[model samples]
Structure formats: structure tokens, C-alpha cells
Target: MRIMLIGRWGKTHALAKALAASRDVELYSLMDKKNTGIASLSAHYELGNIKDLSVIQKFVEKHRIDMLFVVPEMSLARGITDYFNEKGIPAVGPSEFCTKLEGDKGFVRNLMKENHIDHYPDFHVFSDKKEAVEFIRNYSRPFAVKPSGITEGDGVKVMGIQLINKQEAMDYVEQIFDRSIGGMASVIIEEKIEGEEYTIQLFCDGKTVVPMPVVRDYKLLEEGESGLNTPGMGSVSYPNHLLPSLSKNNFDESVVIMERILDVLKEKYGEKYNGFLSGQFMLTEQGIRVVEINVRPGDSEILNIIPILQTDFMDICRAMANEKLDEIKISFAEKSTVCIYAVPEGFPTPSGKVQIHIDRKRFEKPGIHLFQSCFEAGESLYEPSPRLFAVTGTGDSLEEAREKCLEGLSGIRGKNIFYRKDIGTRDLAERYMKKYDLPGV
Candidate 1:
């Protein structure tokens, strides 16, 4: 399996590491701005952005990259995947048009309204602060202001009543402008849906779509979901909650929204437009409403779902690349797994290098998988950095998994290190599992 994975750095780093252990898999090349610690494993390294199609073409030909696995950077990833597909290379990703469903919030909102795919109240798009203020004045407070682009939960800010003042809203718009360029200045302001949120990830080879076990992610930095929003702090999936309801779960509405969204994509975009797909949903009194769509894999969510995947990850990718997904049957682990993300203090930005010491033996019990993240040193001693590594634990129940994850992470010692202590807990996972009312503690 020769695969060309494209992303910024950290994502590519994790992808290469996950695929390296496969005996049949060979990482052909990696295209990124800098070395994401994948140079040691990748057969060839192309040091440049994916926007350079000329360089991408040369690298693909030189290394014979069989398939392209695009990580999160969707705007660029979508464009690169589109370029490769146009060149007649076997690629697995949504088409540029389908990706726009995620790239442009305006487009998505319009689609949802047109299709009557569940609604979360009214939303307005703004290019100027004055018009935005007028719209807010005409309506309610406590709204959600989001950048049309930049998914993975970035560019989303939920304002409370007090924060909805005109000056604060203008400041936020200015911040969005600073982060955006070109016509990206447009922002999506919507009525904030009140309720718990959940993430539903789907795998599609363009046609037969399989929804992964629903996983819950803690988007905030601290407990009670109060703090600055990072990409993803941690995540866990409660299979117990999902088993009862492909039928009767409260989240059945979420599944409906996902199916509806996929239907729209297949109908509007071609069924051959394949790759990973994700749906973010909110469960409210009105039912589950679509929050956003992600065209590629969601990192923290993937960590939770992958263990349950009984099928071979490489085989599925190969089948997608070969256009034989119909012939492949995917299965998942009957047991449960939990994944916890650990980061250094002042993280989501550069902090100084820190040292991490771990008592490997203490947490090396059965059903534990440790994934290395922002570690910079050797196997024995993990030299500290902004992010260190992820510790995942698996057991018969969510509680057991939480215990293992907590214990495993406790073994590691590092200064300026911080992690959500509530990962895998019942209360933490309950909000996400609510829709699927199987059995709860």
C-alpha cells in the first residue's frame, strides 16, 4: 500500500506513525511545509505546501504514491485531492464541491434551509460589522459567531448575553478578519442552539456509508466545557449507548441528520466522491440539528473510533483507492476503548520544551494503546514539547476504561503539563451518549 498523506505537520506525523506498523503498508511520500517527524519513515519527502500541484505531481510520479490520504487541513487538502483526482490518480476524498459543504458555512446553511434538513433557528451572514449589529439588534442575544472556513471546531465562538454587546461583537469580527484572508472575511452568525453537542463520524467510499460508533469530544480546555476552545482536548466513545438504538436512541435524530446530509451530498455531488466524512450535531428539544460537516477525519474522534473498527484500516483505504469498496466488509471491536489527549501548559501555541517521565510498568496492563504525540526525544525518555502523547485505554465498561486512562496518564511526570482529568468519565460521556439512551450510570 503506497499512500501519500498530506497535512500541515502534527496530523501527518500521527498518520505516518499509525500506518508504519502495517507490514503491507509503505508510506510513499509526505508533502508538507516542514518535517513532522515523519522523515524517518517516509520513503521520499517533499518540502513544500500542497498548493504546489507541480511539485505534488512530480513527487507522486517519482514515489508512485498509490493513494492520497488527506488529513484535516480541508481547504488545502480538498484542493490537493481534487487536483490528484483530475490527473486520473486513484484518490479518496470528497470532491471540491462536496468539500465546500464544509468549507463555506453560507453554502451549508443555504443547503440545509433548502433541503429542510433540521434547523437550529435563523442565521445571518455578514461582511460588515454595522449590518451584523443591526441584525443582532433586530433579533436575540447569545448567538454563535463563526468563520465560514476553518473547521475542527476552530472559528466557533458562543457568546453569552453579556458578551453580545456591540463592541465585543465588533472585536470578534476584527479577530476573524485577522485570521482570514481574501474573501474569507465573511462570517456566519447563527442563533446558538441550547443543548449538549455530539460528534458523528462516517466512512464512505462515495457510495455505501457506514457511521462509526458515536464518540464524544471535550472541545473546551477545562471541565464543564468552560475555557478557550482548542482543536480537541480529549474524546471517548460509549458503545453501550449506541447498541440499543440505530432505532430508538435520542440521538436517532442525529443519525437521521447524518443520513440526510449524506443523501444530499451523494445527490448533489457524485457517489464516486469518496473519503472520510464527519457530522457535528446538537441534541436539543427540537431534535438533533446539524452543526457542521467535516470532509476529512476528525483527529480526537478517530482515536476513539479506530479501536472499535474490526476491519483492517489499510484494506479499506486500499479498496477506496481501487474503487472496490462495495466488495469490502467492515467490522468493529465488540469491546470499548478510551483516548485521552495530553498537552503542555500554554499549549495550542508554542511553549518551551518540558521533560516527561513515565512509569511504563504501572500502566502497561492489558488493552492499553499508547500513541506518541508531540514528544521530541527517544523511545525511553520523552523530551517535553508543546504536546506530548496520547494514552488510550480499553476495557469492558466505560468506567474501567476511564480508570485505565487516568492511571496510565498519571505515570507520566512533566512540568507545565495539563490534561482534562475527566476523560472517559460517565458524566463526561453522558452528554454525548444522551441521544442513544441504552443504559447509563
Candidate 2:
């Protein structure tokens, strides 16, 4: 089968490696833009724009592409899958209509409320800053202030980095509505539920849903969970695919909630949903409160889960296209995985010129997978781009995998390069373990 992946960055790199091992699968990546690892991983790729429907259509015809894995949410939001369906091309991704569950938070919140989904939170959306200020002024402690649209992971502000007091909340409201960040015409103030945060990734064909390993991604840049939130610093998952702080029942129930939402989408749109849908959940005393839905795979989270997948990824994609996900067997290895990303010393902030030296042999070591991101491949090694890259380690235990990743990252020698050392550490896992025994406060 001829398969084409449409995306860039580390997530695309990780997806490429996962499907590289499949039989009878000729893989191609469509990177509209130049990025790290593109020069190395994709031998057969179109240098044109990934967002342009014509570029993808031309590549599909020239390569006789049988299946497509549209990786980025942006592309999906722009109706990539809808066009593919029109062309009789099979793809694994949600349609533009489905992206409303992701792109427009207000729509999703209302959908959940109308459907009586258990994960919906108390929230209010406002287009006027005066009404927003007046509403939040008298509101109680511990609330989330968020822009209605994307801010490259900088949109939502809660008790992040530090507790979000009312005054800081006032400032965030001004930043979005007053400053028009991410072109926000509206803002959402949500009841900030306190708890551990994690992401639940699922594979779907608009009917049968298959759940991947539940992964807990760390947003804080510091090891001790201190520091500003980057796109994502690192992530970890156990062999069971459930965090210690989360219960199996909670995981299953959350899946039920998500499945129902998909059912509603299918019924409402009268279209079948096919693709990866991830629910960012905060495990609170009330249950799994879904914070957001990533229309595509999570970045660092995918790096953690792919290594432990026992089933062929292409098989799932094919199943999704064929509407036979339920028939296809889904399985994962009884192993733990850790993903750690390396970025500029002050990542999410631009870094000036800096050459990075990588031990290519480190990627060849047992149980190691390297997904290069911002850095581009050099004649000798690699030169730091902006985001650098990520290394994933798989082992019998999370701690061991973390050590393996840390050891692999230690091989990248450069100046002004930084990564969190605390990811996948036993010390941090112990804290979540304590949460398992704590009564819901």
C-alpha cells in the first residue's frame, strides 16, 4: 500500500518511524515547509506546501497513494480529509466540521453540556471584555482564563507556573480581548478544577473506537514541575497505559464519554469520523474532566506511546480508512516509554545561531528512538534549528526508560541547549502515586 503522511516537526517524525517497519507500505511525507529531520527521514517527499490541497492531490496521483495519514490539526481544520473523501482517497483524520470540537472550545463545551457528558465543566464565554471583567471580578478562587482560539499553547492560563489570582486573571483577560492575541474575538473563563493532567488518545473510524495508551504529558519546563509551560517539555506512560493517580474505571469512563461525543458528531454531521482524537483530561475528584481535544496526535505524547505499540500503525490506518477498526486487533507492548524534548536554552523563545553535535550512534543503541524537530541535519551532525529534537526510550519500567532517554540526550553536545531532567523520573511518579491514595478533596 502506498501511504502518505501530511505533517511536519517531531510528531511527523515519530509517525514516520512507527510506520517504517510495516510491510508493503511505501511511505511519503508532505512537508510544505522545511523542518528538522525532513532531510533525513523522508527519501520520497514533495517539497511543496502541505496545506495546499493541490500539492497533496498531485502527490497522491503521481505516487498512486492508497492511504493518507493527515498529521496536523491545522490541516484537518482546513478540510484536508473532506477533500480526500471527495477524491475517493482513504485517510485517517477528522473532517473540518469535526475540528469545531477542537478549534472552537465554546462549541465543544456546549456540545458536552447538551449531550450530558460527565466531563463538561462550568464555564462562560464572552465576546465583550467589559462583561468578562465584571463576571470574573466576583468569581471565586482557582479559575482558568483562556482565549477562544490557539496561542501556540500559550492561550490558556490557570494556576500555571504559579497560582492564578484574580488580578493576574484580569491581566490575562486583557491580553486576549484587549491585545487580540491569536485573533481572539471571544474569551472563556472556566472553573479551574484542580488535579493531575493527562491526555487520552484514541483511534476511530466514526463508529468503532480504539484507545491508545493513556499518557501524562508534562507542560512545565522545570524538572520539579516548576517553570513556565512550553509546547510540551516531556511525557511518560506506564505499561498499563494508566497513570498511578488515575483509575482504570476512570479511564474507561472517560473513553465512554468521548465515544458518545463522537457518536453525536457522526449523527449531527452525517459523516463518518476517521482519525486520531486526543482528550486532554484532568483527573479531578468528580471524574475525568476533559480540558481539550487535540484533533490530531499529541506531540511528545506520541513519542511516548508509539514505542510500546505492538500492533502495526499502518494496520490501524488501513482499518480506519476501511471502517473496520473494530475488526482490526489493537495491541500495545507491556513496556513503559518516556519522551524528552531538547530545545533552545529558553525554548518557545527564539535562539540565535548555534551548531549542535549529535552522536548518530546513540539512535542506533537498543531501545532508543530519535525524532528530530527544529534542528536540521548537517553534513557532519546536526545544527540547532529552533526546537531541536526529542529522544524516546522504552524499557520494562518508566524509570529505566527515562534513564535511557537522559543518557541518549546526554550525547547531544551543544551550547544553550536545555531539556528537563525530571521527566519519567521515579521521584515524580511517586508524587502521583500518593494522589492515588488521597481522598478527593
Candidate 3:
């Protein structure tokens, strides 16, 4: 089967590696605004972003592509699948109807309540900043200032760090009113629950779902949750696809939540919701509460989850195409995976320019995998991408896996290149583990 993967920088490099080891499947090509990972792939690749439906349709028709798999938020939010269906080509990804889950966090929170899905905290949804400001000034309890629509990653400020005193929160609320930042006119004042957060990802075909490994993705740029949030920094998947301290009951509840939401999405929307459905949840003293959901695959999280998969990547794609997700079997090895992202010195903000060089031979070693995001190379070593590359390490234990990642990252040479030292480490993961053991119940 000829498969065209629609992603700028995801498991493109890793998928290329898997396809090379498989039979009867061809990596048709890739189209991304940047050629970071696409440039390194063995198959043909074109440079174009996942925007503009006309551009994608023309490319698919030109190649006579049999199947299409997309992984970007913008393209999916714009209804790429609906466009592909009209053109008679089978596409895999959330449709315009399904993307509302991620595109509008406020909507999902209400949907959960309407469906009687428990664990959602009491919240107020409002459009005007004046309304939110009034609530913040009067409400005594600490809460999170969040945007009702998509923030990409910004726009949400927690109570302690980002939201300092009541005055600072009022200022943040004013910022939300500004239409320039993601055009977020509405905001949600969510009750901020104290707990540790982990993401549960499942593969769904309109009717059934195959749960992939549960992984934790770090958003903080610094070691101790200090720094502005980007889409993601890195992630870790422990043995058995669950964390050390998370109880079996909590894990099972998350699965049931996903199943119930899947049913609701299929029933609420006429079209079947396909592709990745991720629930970013926090395990708190009150119980497990979902933060939000992403219709597409989590960017950095995919680094660890895809590498150790025993299922053929193409098989999953094919099953998704025919809406036969139940037929596809998923399994993860006992080995743990640690994924690290290397970014330009100015990551969350000003991403300065620098040249990044890596030894392909060093990356070829066992347990080390690299996926390029956005680094440009020239005769004299020119500018670098904001986010350069991702390095992954796999081992029997989390510590060994993390060490492999750190050692492999050393081989990546660049100026103004920095990565979080604490991501996926035992100490950092344990910090969240301790939250579950808190005394206040």
C-alpha cells in the first residue's frame, strides 16, 4: 500500500526507519513547511506546510496517493478529512466536527457535564474580560485563568506562578481580551486542582479504540516547572505504559473515560472520530480530573510512544483508513523510553539562530533515535530551527533510558542549543509521584 504521511515533523524519521524494515508498504512522500525530518527520510519529500486545503488536494491528486495520514493541529482544525472525503481519497485524522474537543477546551468541559461524566470541577465560562475580572476580584479561592478557545499553548496562567496577586490576574484577564493572541475572546475560570498530570492516548476508529502506551509530557522549559509553556518539551513512557505511583484504579478509570468520550463523540457528531484522542488528566486527592483533550497525536509524546511499538505502523494506518481500528493490535515492550527535545537557545520566546551538527553514526547505536523538527543547514552552517531535533533512548529501566538520551544529546553539537536537564528523570517523575501521596484528602 502506498501511504502518504501528512506531517511536518513528527515520527517522520522514526516512521521512515520502521517502513524500511517492513515489506509491501511504501512511504509515498511527505509535505511540511520545514524539511527538518523530511530531509532525512529515504522516501521522496516536498516542502510545504499543512495549511491550505487546495495545496494538499493538488498534491494528493498529483501523486494519486492511496491513503493520507495527517498530524498537525491547524490542518485538522480546518477540516482536512472532510476535504479529502469530497475528493474520493481516504484520509485519517480528526475532522472539523471532532477537532472542537481540542480547539475549544471550554466546549469539552461542558460536554463532559452534559454527558454526566464525573470528575469535572466547577467552572465559569465567560466571553468578556470584565466578567472574568469581576469574578477574580471577588472569588476567594485560587483558580486558573484559561482561554475558552484554542491558545495553542499560551493564554493559560496558573494561580501561584503566572497568576500572582489579584491585580496580576486582572492584568492577565485583560490580555485574554486582546484578539491578537489566538483571537481568544472568551475565557474559562477553572477551579485549579492540585495534583500530578499525565496524558492517556488512545487510537480510535469511529467504532472501537486501541489504547496505546500512557505517557507523561513535560511542558515546562526549566527544571522545576519554571518557564513559559510551549506545546511540549519532552515525554517519558514508563514500563507497562503507566507511572510508578499511579494506582491501577486511576488508570482503569482513565480508560473508561476515554471509551465513554469516544462513544459520545461518535453519537454527537455524525462522522466517526478517528486518529489520536489524548486526555491530559491530573490525579488529585478529589479524584482523576481531565485537563483537556487533543484530537491529534501529542508532538513530543509521540517520540516515546511510537518507538517501542511492536505493531507495524502501516497496519495501524490502514486500519484507521477502513475504520477498522478493532482489527489492529497494539503492544508495548517492557523497555522504558525517554524523549528529549533540543531547541534553539531562546525556546519559549526568542529562538535565536545557530547551526546544529549531529554525528549520524553515534545516533545509529542501539536504543538511540533522532527526529529532526526544524534545523536548516547550508555550506557555511546557517540559521537553526526554533525547535531543532528530538532524541529518544530506550532501556529496561527509566534511569538507563534517560541516561542514553542525555548521552546521545551530547553528540548533537550546536551553539545556543539548550535542553531541559530534568525531563523524564527519576527525580522529576518522582516529584509528581509524591503528589499522589499528599496528606490533605
Candidate maximizing lDDT: 2
Task: Give candidate 2 misplaced runs (Cα > 4 Å).
Answer: 160-164, 178-180, 375-386, 433-441
Clashes (backbone N, CA, C under 3 Å), per candidate, total 6, 1, 2
Better candidate by lDDT, 1 or 3:
3
Candidate 1 TM-score versus the reference? 0.85
- TM-scores, all candidates, are 0.85, 0.93, 0.93
lDDT per residue as tens, model 2, 116-209: 8868678999989888988889887567887877555556777554435777778778778778875658888898786788888999887789
Give model 3's TM-score versus the native structure. Answer: 0.93
Per-residue lDDT tens digits for candidate 1, residues 210-269, read: 677777667778875667777777777665635222334655666667667668766875
User: Taking the tens digit of each residue's C-alpha lDDT, what string does model 3 give over 1-441?
Assistant: 666777665555555556555666666655555455565553556766567787777778777788787777677888888888677787878888888888877788888999999878778888777888999889888888887776665567888867778898888778778753445578888888877788888877778788777788888788776777776788888887777766667788998997887778778766678887888888888888988888876777778877798877777777876788777677778889999888777776755556667888878789988887764556325343446788999999988899989988999897778898798666776666665573221
lDDT of 3 at 251: 84
Stretches of candidate 1 exceeding 4 Å from the true structure: 8-18, 21-23, 29-47, 75-78, 161-166, 178-183, 241-253, 269-272, 357-365, 375-387, 429-440
The lDDT ranking, best first, is 2, 3, 1
